[model samples]
Target chain A: MGRTWTLIRRRLLQAIPVILIVSIGIFGLLELAGGDAVDAYLAVTGGGDPAFAERLRQQWGLDAGLWVRFLAYVESLVTLDFGWSVVMSKPVSVAILERLPNTALMMGAAIAFSACLGTLLGGIAALRKGTAADAGITVGALVLNAMPSFWIGLIAIVVFAVKLAWFPLGGIASFDRPDLAIGRVLDVAWHLVLPVTVLGLAYMALYVRLMRSAMIETAASDWVRAARARGLPRLRIVRRHMARPALLPVVTMLGLQAGNLLGGSVVVETVFAIPGLGSLAYDAVSQRDLPLIAGILLVGTLMVIVVNLLVDITYARLDPRVTDDRVRAGGA
Target chain B: MLKVRDLAIRFAGRSASEAGTLAVDGIDLDLDRAQVLALIGESGSGKSATMLALAGLLPKSAKTTGSVLLDDRSILHLDEREKSTVRGRRIGMIFQDPGGSLNPVLTVGDQIDEVVRTHRRLDRRAARAETVSLLSRVGIGDPAARARAYPHQLSGGLKQRVAIAAALAAQPTVILADEPTTALDATVQAQILDLLVNLVQVEHVALLLVTHDLAVAAAVADRIAVMYAGKIVERRGPEQLVTDPGHPYSRALGQAALPFVAAGDGRHAALPELPGRMAEAGGTACAFAPRCPLAIDRCRAQVPPVVPFGDGEAACFRAGETAQ
Candidate 1:
């Protein structure tokens, strides 16, 4: 546990500079871009007057030089005060925070769905290696892995929503029952089903392949052979001896896949009308919402860094060899 | 007591064009309590294959035909469930690579205690106590403290001792050690071998030590069986087998062994080498005929049988003819 804390402290210290650099990079790129949010605001107000544009630029502090604006952006981030959204007229953090829970719920369900089902199927395939069952799973997982997530999402909406009428085609919930608490929850869950399945299936195939290969390799290892020779029950050998080590690579992939899943959610959210970070970022980019986009990028970068740190710590926990390496390196 | 009769094994090939390869062909062995039989052979000579057959640890592709009798009951015909019940309870197995044999994530105590709990009706606390005692029995100093360490934390020799401790936890009637010290240092190998010999004497357990080194086999084995191309070509008491090898291959192996020198004379000794590769199994009537120095016309056409000697048997036509 002490080692875990030390690792986390070191990782956090390392990540601080990376996060700052990412923030600076995003801020500078957005600042130097061709489009201006003040120009868009003036266009929305149906006026191209020079006085209104100047007033808007000064109000948002866009008149400042690059270094000054970049410092202000870092300062606001440190204070947890994301600047106002020119498009939404609310704090950038508030706009983002409102949509975060929806995206979290969707991605969480997707990851959980994929991980559990993939591991189970992958284990079965490993146990039945070189059999018809193994071939079936291998081919099926490969086929699913090759399909794009948005295409699957669109097809799922058509089949389950348009044809079967079992689920809604779009939006977070049914607007007709907005005030019904239980109904709204059910409606939200129903809307999430297709999107979750699409995202989960895309990742599920990769997980299945990773887990299956890991299991096969681990099962063929001498330790597993020794476990079998110990006369341990077959299930015990599979679970206690083989599963933990096999799942190590899967856990590592999960951390890497988190960032990718966020990117994937944008496509799925656009098709399904879910107002999550993906859709928010898409809108912010199109409408030139610099503060909002910066806020989203900064938060997303931090999340990925933290998740990666957690994965490393989990690796140390799962394989003591990793911990030993750290100890040999003077508790790095 | 354990007896294996005409034990033959063939591993099924991947494709139809390739026939199943015989790995252990028609071998017989017998052992009583409080004796160690070392099955000595080079790589792919069926020594380890024979041991795996006795333990029923071969894969599904391996077709093992013959009988393994443990105290009069036929263990070969048992189902997987019954076989597993008999495995750790009646026969314990020690592997060559001790570091890889133990689970990396588990503590040494947990691993050994699992074997105890599997064979005996004991609570967690009782199992831990038994594991610690077993570790001490294997001569690990500070057994309690060492029990908490993982496989990675211990040295290779210490890991082998932990493996030995786990094997001993079941109180098996027979212990099958497959090159148990092959991965350890020379000094550590000697210590582990001594520990095994002492355990066999103290507990009255039959031990089957499979090794490729003739020296290792001669050191602790009361009886040694030399295997060539999936068959046991000779079986004799260790002293006689080392000094007066019966089969031509056994004589060749003897000449090939590093000669023991009393003092500085060891500096310039040249070891003799066997000249040819081992014949493929089941392809020749006598697998060793192609490599044997005394291969007569009949040696290539006929399979040799184990003929009786003073107290053992040697599977060679020229074995009795040579009076040396």
Candidate 2:
């Protein structure tokens, strides 16, 4: 337990510089893109005079040199100030914070659903390898893996929400029932169903294929054979001896898929019109809101880094052969 | 006593004409308590297949027909469930590489504890204590510390000793060790062989040791069964077989194991090395005839039958004749 904490601490310390560099990179790229916040503000608030635009650039520090502006961005990040969003007319940090929880809720449920269901189904397929079940799952996962999340989301909304009327078409809730908290919560859950399913299905397909191959390989390992030779119960051998090692790959896949899910959320949230970071990122990109874009990029990068770090730790825990030193070297 | 009668194995997905279809063909032997029988042969000689047959550990594609009678009860016909009960409880198997055979994540003590718990009704505490004692019995020094160590943490010989400890946990009447020391260094091989020999005596268990090394079989085995082309060419007491091998294959094997200075003799000069690949099963005549130095027309025309010779058996046509 202490070892795990020490590893976590070491990883977190390493991540500090990576996050700093990523933040700098995001700001530098935005600066190089040559879209001053003054122009975006002018485009949003109707035409303004050149003198007013120059004053706005000076106010937002957009007129400063690239290095001076990047240092200022880093300085603000240290104080948890992500600057103000010229388009949203709110602090960038506040805008991101408002949207983060919704994205977290959708992604959290989606990942949990995919990881669990995929592992169970994949394990079954591997155990029944070369049989009809294995063929069915392999083909099904392949087909689903090829389909885009946005297309799947559109089709799901058409089928279940519009055609069958089983779910609401869009938004966080039935806006009329906001006064009743329970009803509002249930309505929001009902709204989440479509977006979560769309994001989850693509990940589930990859996980099934990844987990099936891993399970088959692990089952054929010498340790599993030894367990059988020792006369351990067949189920016990499958569960304890085989499953744990097989799951090592799945844990790694989970971390890799975390980034994909965030990318996936952009399309899913747009389709469902959910007030999440994905839609916020999309809007910021279209409006060229540099501060908001930089803010979301930082958050997204931090989330991915944290998730991958957790995956490494979990992988090390699963296979004793994996040590903190190896994970550090490999991660680097 | 473990009596193996006419034990033959033909793996599935192959007809009689298919090459390498039959792994073990019509093998018969008996092992008494405290006796060690080594199935000696080169790679692809079906020595390991014969041992795997006894414990029902052969792949599902294998079709085995014959009787493996353990104390008068036939085990060959038992289904998977019943056969599992026989394994570990009645017959324990030790695979080729000790390092690969044990789970890397599990501690040595955890592995032995599991074996004891599976075969017996011991509580967790008692099982742990039993594991420690079992480790000690296998000649592992500092058994307590060794028990907590994983397979990778231990040396190859120590890992082998731990594997032996796991097999002994069942207190099985018979133990099948398939090239147990093949992956170890020369010094470690000797230590592991000593441990196996000591366990066979101290536990009074019938051990079927399979190996490709004649030296290994000669050093540890009481009785040696030399197999060639999926058939036992000779089965005899160690001393008799080493001194006066009735079969040409056994004599060639012995000569191959001889030191450099003793390589020449007037009658058996230029030690005859067997030629050609092992004959596939269902051949009309002796499988070794194609490689035998003493092969004649009749030797290829008919299958050699096991003929008794001085308290042992050999399947050579001219058994009593000295090679010239």
Candidate 3:
């Protein structure tokens, strides 16, 4: 337990510099894009007086030097207060927290659905290599992977939402009731169907291919032959010997893909019109809400870091041969 | 005791025009308990295939025709489950490359303990204790510490010892060692062979030792079967096979063994070497006739049946003449 903690701590520390650089670079790009809280405030508030905008800019420290503004941003981050969003007129942290749960809910569902379907299909395909089932799955995965996520989402909405009238095309929940109960949750889920399916299919296709390749490679290894020669039952060989090592590479790939998924969710969320972080970030970009955009970028960066860290810990647990020092060192 | 009769294996050819190639022809072998029988042959001589068939570990694609009897039960007819029950529980196998045979992720102790846990209903603690004891039995030092070490952490010789320990964990009645010492250094090979012989002797287990080296077979085998082109051409006591070979292939192997000695000594003339490679025998009269220097008109026209010599068998029409 102590060793694992040490490993996690070491990994967390190493990620700090990477996250710092990423955040700074994102903040710098947002600044260079010629946007400010004063402009967003004037636009959202329907053109306030010039003096009011100037006072607001000075109050938010937006009228300071770049380094001073960066230092203030870091200080606010350390204080767990990401300043106020000029467009939403709410604390950036509150806005992020409010929207984060929705994104989390969608991502969680997609991951769960994809992992189960992908692993099962991958295992079957690998076990029946060169068979019809394998060929069908390989072709299906190629098609799914090659298709654009937004296009898939739009097509699903057209078929299931507009044409079939089975689901709502936009928004997270039915606008009539906004309570956080089981019925409302189900309604939200109903609306998330197209987006989640699009994201899940895109992600699961790659996982299946990865798992199939890894399993095929592992099956050809000598240890698998040794396991067979030991006279173990076939299922036991697949479950105990072949599956674990094969899944190791899959786990690593899944972790990296999860990070990519968070980034790619922007397109899917916008297409589905779901009020998740991806849609929120897209709205901020269109309105040029600097504070909100920076906050979203920070949140996305943090999500990547946290997910990767969790994956590293999971990897260490699954395969003890992967030492903490190596994971902390990071990347080939 | 174990016996294999009329064993044959045919592999499908890549092209439709070519007939299925016979990897092992009608070969027969018998080994008594507490004795080692060495299957000696070159790479393509069907020695390993015959052993795999006898062990019931042959791939599903290959066609096998034979009766492999372990004591009284015919193993060839058994289903996969029954074959597995007979394999590690009653018949243990040691593969050629010890490094490749052992799992890299597992500790040596866990690997051996797995064998015990598979065949026996021992608890984890009891299985682990037995694993350490088996490790010590295989002559590994610091058995407790060694049990926790993975295969990559150990040397090649140590890994082989771990393999032997795992094989012995089941207390099998028959152990098939396929070139067990081929990958080890000279001194380690000697030690591993000594450990194998001592363990087999003490446990009264039948050993089917397979090797291409005549000298290695001579070192540990009680009876030697020289295989040529998927058939056992000759079977005799180790001393008789080495000193008075009957079949032409056995004679060639024996002469090849002589070159291992220092080359410059004038006191003894160099041994005669066989000419040409062993050609792939098709559906022909005799497999070795193409490579035999003394092949006559009759030798090419007819296959030789197993003829009894002193206390062994030789499949040659002119065994006595060949010996001369």
Candidate 4:
């Protein structure tokens, strides 16, 4: 337990610099791209009353130096109090928190679906290597992997939502009556069908291919042969000896893929019109809502860091060879 | 007691035009309880294939036709489940490469414990205790600590000891050690051989030692069976086979075993080399006839039956003439 804690601590320390650099660079690029928020606001409001713009600028501390603004942003982040949104006229943190659960729901469902389906397919393919079933799976995974996520999402909507009338085509839920209970949950799931399936299919294809190769490689290892020679049952041999090491590489790939899901979700979310962070960020960009955009960026960065930390801890537990001290040092 | 009678194994080639090759053709062997038999042959002599067939570990494509009887029960007809029960419990096997045979990730204790658990109904803790005792029995000091170490942490000699310990975990009636010391250094090889010989003696287990080296076979085998192609061409006590070889192949192997002598010693005659390789054994009349300098017209067309000798057997038509 003590060792595990040490590893976690080391990983956290290492992530600090990465988070800082990424946030700083993203914040700088967004600021430079949008120009001064106060000046942009003044122009948008038709240069009406220089006095009102001046007062607004003073109240928001928009006149401060760039370094001062950066420090203020960092301070607000540490205090868990991101400033009010300039365009939406609401707290940025509140808006982000509202949309977070929806994104989490989609990502969690996609991961669970991909892992279960991919592993089963991969295991079956490995057991039947060189057979028609194996060749079909290999070719299918290649085709699925090549399909673009946005295009897949649109096609899913056309086939299942519009054509079949099986699911809702857009929006997280029926906007007429918003409820967080079972009925509303089903409604949201209906809307989630296109995006989640598109993302999951792509991820499943890649994972299946990786897992199939890993299983095949491990099946040929001498240790596996030794296990078979011991007269162990076939199922036991596959489960105990073959599966464990085969899954090691998959664990690392899954961790990296989890990070990618958040980044890559943007296209899928746009095609489905889901009110998640991706859609929120897209809206903020077009409207020049710097405060909302910055808030979304920070949230995305933090989520990625948290997911990485969880992966490191999970890896340490799964593989005994990965000690806490090494994890901590490596994480650093 | 164990007996392998008329054992033959053939494998189909990639094409129909090519005849199926016979790896082991009509070989016979007998081993009494607590007896040690050495099967000596070079690589590709079907020695390993015969051993695997006897153990019921042959590949799916291999076609074996024989009666491998363990105390009158024919093992060739047993199902996989029945064969497995007989394998680890009745006939334990130590493979050629100890390093490759043992699982690297597993602790030495865990590996041994698995064997005990598979054949017996001991709880985990008791099985572990038994594993430690087995390790200590194999001459490993600090058995408890050693049991916790992985295969890679142990030296080559220690790994072989672990393999022996695992093989002995079920208190098997017969132990098949296939080239057990082939990969070890000279001193380590001697120690491992001594350990095996001692364990077999103490356990009163029938030992089938397989090796290509005549010296290794001579070290511990009570009876030596010189295998040519797939058949045992000569079977006798070690001393008789070494000092008074009957078949030409055995005579050639014995002469080759003579130690190298100095260049100036006229008494040290030049070592005689065998004429040809072990022929492609395809249910041939006599596998060694192509390679034998003593081959006659009849040798090519007829398979020689085993002729009885004093407490042994030799398969050669000219055994009567060669005996004198």
- My TM-score estimates for the predictions, one after another, are 0.93, 0.93, 0.88, 0.83
Task: Calculate DockQ per candidate and list them.
Answer: 0.69, 0.66, 0.49, 0.32
lDDT of 1 at A259: 93
Q: Tens-digit lDDT track for model 1 on B88-108?
A: 778889999999899988899
Residue pair clashes in candidate 2: none
Write model 4 residue lDDT over A1-332, tens digit each, in one string. 77667766776777779877876886788777855566667667777687887787788887778889889888876787878877667899888888898888888788777776787788779989999999998888778879888888888888998999888888788877556588787878877877888888888887788789989987887666655556566786677667766776777777788878886677778988888888887767765676688788878877777777777776766555555347455554
Better of 1 and 3 by TM-score: 1
User: Could you list the iRMS of every candidate?
Assistant: 1.1, 1.2, 1.8, 2.5
Per residue, candidate 2 scores C-alpha lDDT tens digits across B173-208 of: 999999999899999899889989998989999899
lDDT of each: 0.85, 0.85, 0.82, 0.79
Select the stronger candidate by TM-score from 2 and 4: 2
* Per-residue lDDT over A26-135 for candidate 1, one digit per residue giving the tens place of the 0 to 100 score: 97788778667877666667877788788878987888887787788889989989889877789998999998888888988988888888988898898899999989
User: Which of the two, 3 or 4, has more TM-score?
Assistant: 3
Error of 4 at B292 (Å): 5.3
Q: How large an RMSD does model 1 have?
A: 2.8
True contacts kept of each: 0.57, 0.58, 0.35, 0.18
